[model samples]
Target: MSKTVRIPRRSRAGILAAIILGICLLLLLTVGVLTVGAADAHPPRLVDNAGLLSQAEADSLRATLDQYSEELNFDIVVVTTNTLDGKTPRDYADDYFDYNGYGYGANRDGALFLRYINGSSKEVWLSTSGEGIKAIRDADIESIFDDMEDDIRANRYGAAFQIFAQDVRDEVLDYRSYDTIWIFVGLAVGLGVGLIATNAMRSSLKSVRQQRYAGSYIKGNSVNITEARDIFLYRTVSRVAKPKESSGGGSSTHTSSSGRSHGGGGRSM
Candidate 1:
């Protein structure tokens, strides 16, 4: 008799290949999504307009300039500074910057640089990136001028400061909220890809195990019947019961013993 052989399952390399393949598929899908991906970030960058400062803000500065110029022949240049220089402006329509002086659609910290086009010999320059006028006030444009005047009169720059701390503070706040959202989205994508790889590897490993014992193993829902023996059932021929008859003139009789018996081939007496 021919013996039945067990089927061999797949190997580790095979399973590893499957998992790697699944990961590659996921990465390909990610690439496709990127081609058409929408915003999935914090503070919900889902809108077309993000991080855009208000027109009123620029106008307010303009108003301040106009107020400052109330009967003078000077020009007020209100350029929205590019503080973070983030990839996109915070808003749909805002100031921009080019090779020349700052233009519309540019995003930057709140700042106001002031100088006399043709007036003060004692020039006052003010620039800030504050959230509001309160923050602007903290930069103390008025005080800086006052101090500069005093220092010049005394022939000493004891009040000299080339940079302002308030601009950094303002820019940090604006970019902080947006940058965090971008980071969160990136992390989520990476995590999802990892989970897909893990599950695919587990599935491929199970497939390999099943291939190892395909012919002999009776795979139940969750468990495999590995140790079951193959049984060949045979049957000993059953004997037929014989009929009994009285001691008469024309009758035959027989008795059954163990597994042997007589049949109806005998003739009557």
Candidate 2:
């Protein structure tokens, strides 16, 4: 006898693997969309500058911030405040960063006094840090703004704005890196939502299909039913055809096997 080789059939396993792979891909896609979607903060952050921007300027900046928001998926709030009279970084502990929520200064522990000017699509600044244009980190952004407070108070608005804008541009150029956990969470939430929705839809369709398949078959059957007969006495009908009648010169009579006769029989005399 010759031995024959058969490629062991693995079709079922292959199909199962394909289905799992498809589901995983779908889940990943959902996560990616959620991870990269726009964030909550658009232009005009600081939450306090709500009413300061003119309609035209606010509209333009809003558009710019909106673009950034979509890209970074984070909100960046902005605020502009005047310096307190006779205040300097050395005068007293500053609360500018404290009030703004950026956190207290990292190096100086004091607010820098500078002037703020205009902002564009990506940046907001007052002046150089005096040491160097240390990339516009959010923590330092606040200090830069506080530093400009003095220039603004002195009515050097143009110079103040130039420094502010320059720093902002640098900060944006150095977009911040985010925590990896947030990315994973975003993907998890998206995948969960997709799976739930897909399962619900599949369940509904399965029920409908079952109903359709069941409806295709028809039943044809017959059954024998039992019948009943009733019997009673006195004033009630006891037989199918029982009556009194005359036959010839006699009242109608009938004879049964037991020799019982009714009134419809003929008599001899």
Candidate 3:
């Protein structure tokens, strides 16, 4: 004959608690690993190689960039370099954005503001990627440069860059709004066409006639109604003006040295 041994209630509770704790720890570890992997995917946003900004200024600008980038889901980067390593300003700016993992999504949606300093002369380039190509038009790029020109010429690099970041954010937002409006217009047009087609089809059925009462289509006692009334909730009114014609075009794109397409423009300062 054999005797069965039983575990104490306290011991059993302790074992169950330990197992739960282990599972929680494992989940936390997995989450931590994923977070680190995601962070590692994107490179630094501000690279002051020429050391144009003081530490305090760099920190403040970085915070601004990070805030806008997160809100817009687009990367906005700034780089200051003493040399382009023998490459043209355009090529250098494009390569740096592409190779350094500066973009946000798979198509790498982002924009880079490069300020290249060579002795007494300075050159600035704006490189855009992915949706950025659509958002930052040629006119918008010129406007950005125009806004920054005075500060840049006065050796206020920090102020100029701040303007660059803010202008890029505004342009992206405006483009998105414009695109959304077109989408809604398309949807409205489609709905109207569908309604017209459906009405035409219904009109072809001569046997069907308009019902004078709602109960005509319902089975007796199937639905009960004590009282009913139609209520007007709201109304919408829209007015649009004729769009003015302009000579300027949208963003112009070119293939970068890395075989990736980029939209950008550069100016000597």
Tens-digit per-residue lDDT, 1-269, candidate 3: 99999999999999999999999999999999999999766677899999989888899899889989989999999999999999999999999999887887788999999999979768999999999999998888999999999998898888888999999999989989999999999999999999999999998987989899987988888887899999999999999999864436877788998899999998998
Q: Candidate 3 local accuracy as lDDT?
A: 0.91
Q: What's the lDDT for all of these models? A: 0.36, 0.41, 0.91
Candidate 3, position 227, lDDT: 100
- Model 2 residue runs over 4 Å out of place are 1-11, 37-50, 62-77, 80-163, 166-269
Model 3 regions more than 4 Å off: 1-27, 30-34, 187-248
**Two-way lDDT contest, 2 vs 3, winner:** 3
Candidate structures ordered by lDDT, highest first: 3, 2, 1
Strongest candidate by TM-score: 3
- lDDT of model number 1: 0.36
TM-score (C-alpha, index-matched) for candidate 3: 0.70
- Expressed as tens digits, the lDDT of each residue in 20-84 for candidate 2 is 99999999999888776633321233322324445555555555444443343332333443333
How many residue-pair clashes does candidate 1 contain? 20
Residue 184, model 3: Cα distance from true site in angstroms: 2.1
Runs with alpha carbons beyond 4 Å of true place in candidate 1: 1-9, 12-109, 112-124, 128-130, 148-159, 166-269
Greater-lDDT candidate between 1 and 2: 2
What RMSD value applies to candidate 2? 43.0
